[model samples]
Target: MRMPYRVVGGTLVAALLAQLAGCGTLFWPERRGQIEGRVDPVIAVLDAIGLLFYIIPGVIAFGVDIATGAIYLPGGTHAQVDPATLRPAVQPDGTVNRARLQAILQQQLGRHLPLDDPRLIEHRGSPEQLAAYGLVPAA
Candidate 1:
């Protein structure tokens, strides 16, 4: 016998599949042009499956990230911006200057980051662009 969780999961999966099928109709024109000939039901099913698997997770993750108020940039340091000053200070060589570290932190993390939160500002990393200058993380 199937567990209760399994039954709910199966129901959710079926609902998702139905929604995907309805959505496929909207893309028929684009698919027709790409396929260049006969409309293959098998190919359409495969494409819809792939689309559902890829899009749903990506959208959920993006929504969660936004809700948490955090921005993750690839290879870039995350830092809080100073709402009052709106700048992260840098040294003459563009390294993270401890004296003007607040400004440096803002610049590295981008103006969009929440600088009002002291917790986030304190945890920011050094900018990759300035890493070669032998600069250390500010305490």
Candidate 2:
């Protein structure tokens, strides 16, 4: 005896739906809020596989993953540094007090900052750009 077409199809559809239900959020909750980071290829491929079974559910899975930022790789652009921690290093002269900053960083981070390292870049933004971000450059 063979299974009826409807029963076989229903079983296959149910199994596929179960596989698709494991969206990126369910798999990688820790990766949430990483909107601008790289997409996790594993999740991307898994979501794409859903497209083979059904277009709408696959698209929805992709949409949910992207919107919730669960599809992104953690700790790329998602890593945030607190500006308040470095505020003490900015001098009235509109320059960074490297010695003071290094000392503060050492105390807080438990590591020595190479103040004179050439790899450390200082970006002086334009006044207009600063204004756009609601920041005022020290006069």
Candidate 3:
């Protein structure tokens, strides 16, 4: 009993493509659930797949879970803060007070974000605030 050449070729091609796609990231571990504090979703799903010996559904579930927004999006131009009313004056070095900036962000965003981290507050200068600071928007 031998498989057809076409069947074998198709299987080989599919396996090669799957390997090239780097499916490992799909199974990457998420943090332990706060409730259980021990069950790792990724590992649990993977272990279930091992028991079932069916990879497709496991891979699909893993991809869906990982692609979900567990990560925060970087705040860009839309996140810029108004300097005047916010009351955080930029210093000579073009930096604002960390605490003041955090306060303003909390007020505007209605949540406490880590503004002390430059990454969160980078590119956060508002044009209206700049105008009040005697600066004009670059055309």
Candidate 4:
């Protein structure tokens, strides 16, 4: 008789790969309260059962980075905000509208990068403007 477990095992491995391939959004830090209804129950059950092994540490690190006011998520650096979008956040009063800046930056980059982030300071002010604010631009 043919080996029966090979068929079952192969199907399980394929399903697992498919589930992981689609989990990109599920792990993103910005997906809170929005991404929903697409879970594979099999994967969900497997993940739930194995959560402590790897997922818990990742979640804890995400939480700690959030508490620290980090500009990006914990894994790696993301691209800087486009200077085009950053330009308009300058208000008529000549101050950066930090609230507006935060919203735009979050939408464009999926991270809460601050206007004063080093990556952003050059985009925000001319040399004279930065001096007026008692700030210096990096070369």
Candidate 5:
């Protein structure tokens, strides 16, 4: 009667929806239709129902697997997942703080090769600096 037709119509609608949401087993049997590690709520519920309904495929696959001696290789129907990662963000901005940098540079360089006089350092590379420091005129 009317009850029979009602049930049939409802079953058809549910089946169509299940297919649309990627339910059922075999192939992309999404444990959950997850996006970025979080499963869609509707899909999550559908997935649970799908798991229950999947007994059909699960049984068939069992037979096929036993016949074929087992194989269930996931090929791209799987979701790629990674946890949120945090790392230091550093950059070399590339601007030489001329005065401060040069001062530190000169200080460090002095540690390895001591400059004779602080005065010669001021007029660096001048003939007078070289003569006073005994580098050019004095070998």
Candidate 6:
């Protein structure tokens, strides 16, 4: 048995239209948890390209991504301080002095930090372990 040409054509058209829409949501479904944040530039560019080629599909893409929360960057707070710079915060035992670490971080960041927050992660390691990461303990 052979399928009708109309049926095959219609199916192709529908698939193509869906393909042209919502690249962000379709491509990065894992980014769905964030409700709001800076828009991901790569995704924005892709959606804009779709918009440039076809208005309806492009608009649908943007709408779908925004609605699904896939258009925004991951939302969280994190900081990267150089291991060498943080050496002063490490104790001889390789544990960080919480108060001293907080003061160091606050001074470097020029802001108040809740280092004592139980919800935040605090790392403890041996002096040798810390040395592996370039964070040598004080003598």
- Expressed as tens digits, the lDDT of each residue in 33-131 for candidate 1 is 121223345434544454556777435433333333222212233344443342245444444445465455545565433444433424345566245
Q: Backbone clashes per model, in order?
A: 6, 0, 0, 0, 0, 1
Model 5: pairs clashing at backbone N, Cα or C within 3 Å = none
Residue pairs in candidate 4 whose N, alpha carbon or C atoms collide under 3 angstroms: none
Could you estimate the TM-score for every candidate?
0.22, 0.49, 0.36, 0.30, 0.23, 0.41
Candidates 3 and 5 compared: the better one by lDDT is 3
lDDT by residue (1-139, candidate 4, tens digit) is 3567888778767655544432323444353322123433433444443344356533543343333323132343547766667767766456667888888889988876555543331335577966665545556
Which residue pairs show backbone clashes in model 6?
Answer: 22-61
Rank order by lDDT, top first? 2, 6, 4, 3, 1, 5
Which residue runs of candidate 3 sit more than 4 Å off their true CA positions?
1-83, 86-89, 116-139
lDDT of each: 0.43, 0.73, 0.48, 0.50, 0.38, 0.73
The numbered model that scores best in TM-score is 2
The total number of steric clashes, by the backbone 3 Å criterion, in model 5 comes to 0
Q: What TM-score does candidate 2 get on C-alpha atoms? A: 0.49
When summed lDDT is taken over every stretch of 10 residues in candidate 5, the lowest stretch is 82-91
Q: List model 6 lDDT by residue over 1-139, tens digit each.
A: 3568889888767655655653887788887645567999888887776676668777878888777778888866666777777877776655678788888888777767777644343445666876797665756
lDDT of 4: 0.50
Where is the poorest 10-residue window by lDDT in model 4? 31-40
- What is the per-residue lDDT of model 5 for residues 68-100, given as tens digits with 9 covering 90 to 100? 322323234432222111001111332224444
In candidate 6, stretches whose alpha carbon ends up further than 4 angstroms from where it belongs are 1-22, 76-139
Instruction: Note the residue pairs that clash in candidate 2.
Output: none
